[model samples]
Target: MKQFIQGIKDGGAIGIGYLSVSFTFGLAAVSSGLQWWEALLVSMMNLTSAGQFAGITIMAAAGTYIEMALSQFVINLRYALMSISLSQKVDKDFRAGRKMLLGFAVTDEIFAVAMSREGEVSSQYFAGLAVLPYLGWTGGTLAGAVCGNILPKTVTDALGLAIYGMFIAIIVPAMKKDSRILKITLLAVAFSFIVYYLPGLRNISSGFAVIICAVAASAIGAVCFPMEEEQEGA
Candidate 1:
């Protein structure tokens, strides 16, 4: 119980951050043609900001289901790796079912918090850790969706710019710390521009363009800048 309480307290900040990000997502989703309830449903189901944004973009572009699937699979591949890493940190008695349930809530922030702990993470602790962020994400999305419906078009459009700010905030710090990341970020940007502007490539759907840019840049980045032996061992 004590550990659970501690988890909730620790998760409070992540919850607040999620609220802000997801609120912008809600506005964008609705403004892009999704109904308010649909936007809320998206927040409830998908916790990843990047994945959600990509998915929404694909939907808005009237892309096919296969494109959506491929985009999501590529965009969210890191979570599978995160889940594998998190598995090693769980308590011995945490059964498969509990682990699976907890896996559903293992966002990047939650995984980081759990991994940084001194020892094994109890299921209760992980469950508590997930609670606030989930609620805040869903609640903020619903609020934003509702507000999108009621607010004037210009106001909603202006508020929608916040998501770009959020993405920049997330990326800039990491780029500053790692030259490899900076290169990869630049490469991805170049790929995106080429896909959007190059004569033949411009004909591709927006969704497939995203997939191509992400996969190509990441593949090149991985090949060119493999993790060091120590990091691989860790």
Candidate 2:
């Protein structure tokens, strides 16, 4: 019980950061012709920042259902990978039903926090960590949908920086710990720029570009940094 409470406290701190960005998501939804409740429902179900943004953008642009579905499929495929990694950290006694319920809460931020745990993670602790952020994300979207029009354009522009900041926060520590991550980061940036400029690839859909980048990067990483026998055991 104590550990569970601690997880909620930890999650609440992280949730505060999400509030600002979700506000923009809400605003965009309303501006893009979605009802506030629909916007809120999207946030609640997805619980992912980039995926939701891409999905809404495609929807607003009158993209085909196939395009929207494919975009989300590509963007969110990372979560599937993250879940596989996290499976090793869960308590051995955790039931299938519990895992299914908790699986839906696996966002990048939550996975990062959970992976950093020092030992096997209890379901209670995981659930506690999920609660506040889940609520904050849902509530923040609603708030933004309702109040977006009143916010200054400059403030909204500045709020865009938050996503970049969040990415940096996630990347810096990993880069500091592993030269492989640094190398991969550089490679990804170079590859992205190349794709952005090269005429054939530049015109491709963003969803396809993301799939290419992820697969190429992961392949390179696997070749360069194959897991050791000991790591396989863990």
Candidate 3:
């Protein structure tokens, strides 16, 4: 019980940082003409910054269903990779139903925290950790939708920086642990920016750009950093 409470507390601490960025998301949704309930629904269901952002953008513009589907598919595909990685960490006895239930909460931050655990984790702990962020995300969107343009532009601009700050927070610690990861991350970021800004590539949709960058980076990393096998001494 104590550990579960601690997990919830820790998750809430990280989730508070998300509120600032989610606030901006909410405001954007409202500005795009989404109703308060609609904005809240997106946050509650998606629970992903990138996917929600892309989905709302296409939605606001009344994009076709195919476009919206592709946008969401591209943005959320990382979760599939995360799931595969996490499967290796979970107890073999973990039930399929439970895993499926918990999978909905598998965000990048959540996955990082869960993976850091040394051994088999109680589902209770994972559930506790997920609850606060889930609420914070939905609550922040609701607040933003209700507040709407009431917030000054300067405040929104500052809030917009929160997502980048969160990414930095995740990366900095990992980079400290592994210089190799740092190098890879830097290379990937540089490549992504080049592709994003290049004359011909710049014309591609942001969703497609993300897919291309992720695949290229992962492929390059795998080839450059293959695992070594050790020989046994007789």
Per-model TM values vs. the true structure: 0.92, 0.71, 0.69
Clash counts per candidate, in order, are 0, 0, 0
RMSD of 3: 5.7
What residue pairs clash in candidate 1, if any at all?
none
| lDDT head-to-head 1 vs 3, winner | 1
Q: Which model is ahead, 2 or 3, in terms of TM-score?
A: 2
Error of 1 at 186 (Å): 0.8
Minimum summed lDDT over a 10-residue window in model 2 is located at 225-234
Write one digit per residue (lDDT tens) for candidate 3, span 1-234: 775786697688658866876887787777666788999998988889878877876775566687788778866877897889888877765578888898899998887788777786666777778888888888888888788757676765565555456567757788778666777778778878998888988876655565577667757876887544332110
List, residue by residue over 106-157, the lDDT tens digit for candidate 2: 9888888998999988888899999888988998999988875566767655
Please tell me which model should have the higher lDDT, number 2 or number 3.
2
Question: In model 1, which runs have C-alpha deviations exceeding 4 angstroms?
Answer: 158-160, 229-234
List the candidate 3 regions with Cα displacement exceeding 4 Å: 149-234
lDDT of 1 by residue, 1-234 (tens): 998999999899999988988888888888777999999898888888889988888898899999999998998898898898888888887899998777889788988888888899998899899999999999999988887888898886786676667678888998888888889889998999988988988889888887888889979989998997355311
Candidates 1 and 2, the one with greater TM-score: 1
The deviation in Å at residue 52 for candidate 1 is 0.8
